[model samples]
Target: MTTAVLALQGAFAEHESRLKELGETVIELRDSDDCALAFDRLILPGGESTVQSKLLKERGMDTLLRRKIEEGMPTFGTCAGMILLAQHVDNGQGGDTQSGALATFPACVRRNAYGRQLGSFHTVDTFADMQVPMTFIRAPYLDSVEDSVSVLSRVDGNIVAARWKNQLVTAFHPEVDSDTSVHEYFLRM
Candidate 1:
């Protein structure tokens, strides 16, 4: 299956590499035209959510993406991508007014909930029953998840990962690591 990775900014290249390593066709989605391409899955990689959101809207791809996602496209969002997919973002740095979020996941997200860049960290966390080392760089954490959301993993008493329908999100960067366990699980989903 083909997976479209938003390459507007951030660690998109890393995600594409990981997906390719898994033997999956990868597409770099930059603008609205790229959205027309046939793809089975989508990956919103770790990056600056505000910047990514701005680019999507400016390029008129946000609307198209929301439509596709609502149509049941399987998506995997990491870090800032998680913030983009959230139904509500408690982005302490003022509300998301300029470039709004996709609001796909039925949850509230606090941008940089893990603190500043100096607050970045890494740890071996259990995800889907496997111990994987997660890297968190100025990541956001889920404050609340609705009943429709299934908690996938947690770290330090915070909800770091969850899934809702065909959408999955993580506060850590799995693509930056060598382990493909998480990516494999997403493919299986």
Candidate 2:
């Protein structure tokens, strides 16, 4: 199946490489026209959420993407992508909230829940019942989730990954790691 990776920013290249390694046709979606391409699934790569959100709106892709996800498109989002899909977002400072971009995932996310760049680290965590390498870079975590959401992985008592219907999200970057299990799971979905 063809998978479209949002290429406006962040780790799209890494995700593209991993998907290619798994023998999947990859496409980089850089604009609204790219979003119109026929793809079986989507990967919203980690990046600056605010910037990505603004770009999506300015490029006329926000509505289309949200509609696709809402229409049951299988999607995987990491880090800032998680923030983009969340129904609610806490900026991680004094409980301030920010408007989400897609708002298709049924969870409340906290931006920069683990602090800043210096707070970034790597660790192996349990994901979908298997141990996998997890790399957190200025990540955000799910502060809360709806009952329909299934928790997939957690670190230090914080919810880092979850799945709701066709949507899967992680606060950590799986494409940056050597493991392909996460991408495989998305493929299965």
lDDT (C-alpha, whole model) for all candidates? 0.90, 0.94
Model 1 misplaced stretches (Cα beyond 4 Å): 93-100
Candidate 2 local lDDT, residue 173 = 97
Please give, for residues 57-106, the per-residue lDDT of candidate 2 as tens digits. 99999999999998999999999899999999998678878658999998
The Cα error of candidate 2 at residue 141, in Å, is: 0.4
Clashing pairs in 2: none
Global fold similarity of model 2 (TM-score)? 0.98
Q: After superposition, how far is residue 164 of candidate 2 from its true place, in Å?
A: 0.1
Against the correct fold, how does model 1 do in TM-score? 0.95
Error of 1 at 186 (Å): 0.9
Q: Which RMSD does model 2 reach against the true structure?
A: 0.8
What TM-score would each prediction reach against the true structure?
Answer: 0.95, 0.98
